[model samples]
Target: MRILILGGTGEASALVRGLAGSGHAVTLSLAGRTAAPKPEAVPTRIGGFGGPEGLARYLTENGVDRLVDATHPFAARISRNAAEAAAMAGVPLLAIRRPPWERQAADAWREVGSVPEAVAALGEAPLRAFLTVGRQELAAFAAAPQ
Candidate 1:
């Protein structure tokens, strides 16, 4: 089967490696946001496909049998585009979602809807806070009192 994998995260890379020698033609797509992305196991294509229409066109033109959306969980636009493109192209789509972090008894977790909310939740008091957000979003938390 010919597979197109929308990838960037570690999970995506692992999927590519797992698919190696599986007798399927696999192509991995990267967003091109990273200055130096790790080399992938499968054939790779960098940058966006315009939008859903363009992605659908690529799927049809390349005769892509399946689409695996393995993009970062925070990439909503690409995920939406992939879903729309799969529907438009009449191709089967599968998403490899990241499992949510499990809270342990010793863990102090504060869930917030957005980065701003997280910053707001930090309060005005100066405190040592360890943020686990991606580097791209670090700017949002810069104003937090920490």
Candidate 2:
């Protein structure tokens, strides 16, 4: 089976290494955020496939049979695109969704649907809130001033 993995997180790298020499053709796709990503056991393709349409085109053109989404949990856009593309191209999709962080006794973690929603959930409070979401998402919090 021809497999295409949308990867960036460590899990993806480890999974790629595990699939080494498995006989089935495999390719890992990275977003090229970093100049040098860790070497993978299988062939790696850097950069985006435009969006869902472009990704669908790539899947169809490359004869990809399976699409695995091994991206970071914060990569909501690509994950959605992967599902859309997989559906459009009629390829099977296997998303490796990481389980959400388990809540602790003192944990005050509140999950919001989107960044904007998170900011709104702050309720105009000028409080110090640790944003451990993602690096790129930090800029959106500036509006909250919390």
Candidate 3:
């Protein structure tokens, strides 16, 4: 069976490595969002297949039998698009999501529902905050009250 893995996460690479010596045909797809996407252990293809319509078309054109979504936890757009396209094309879809890291006693965590809220929670004080959420949400802290 032809398996297309939507890979941009570590779990995806692990999956690819695990399935390394298998005879099943596997193709890993990436969105090309990064200048250098995480290296893949399996064959990879970059860029989108347009949108839902294009993905559907590709699924039909390539005879893809299965889809494995191994994208990042916050990659909602591509995940939604892939699900819609998979359903439209009548292909089986499997979400290979990684288990979220749980905060432990050794770890300090301040949980907030939104980025704006997190910024507000920081209060009007000059403080050193570690922005670990990623580059996209780092802007929220730029105008934080001092």
Best by lDDT: 1
Q: In candidate 1, what are the lDDT values of residues 1-40, reduced to their tens digit? A: 9999999988898999999889999999999999888987
What is every candidate's alpha-carbon RMSD to the true fold?
1.6, 2.9, 2.6
Error of 1 at 19 (Å): 1.7
* Best candidate according to TM-score: 1
Off by over 4 Å in 3: 101-110, 126-132, 144-146
When summed lDDT is taken over every stretch of 10 residues in candidate 3, the lowest stretch is 128-137
**Colliding pairs, model 3:** none
lDDT of 2 at 84: 99
Worst 10 residues of 1 by lDDT: 127-136
Candidate 2's error at 11, in angstroms?
Answer: 1.4
Alpha-carbon TM-score of each model against the true structure: 0.90, 0.81, 0.81
lDDT of 2 at 65: 94
lDDT per residue for candidate 2 within 1-146, as digits (tens), equals 89999999988988888888999899999999878888888999999999999999999999999999999998989999999999999999999988876778987876888888888888775876766587788788887856
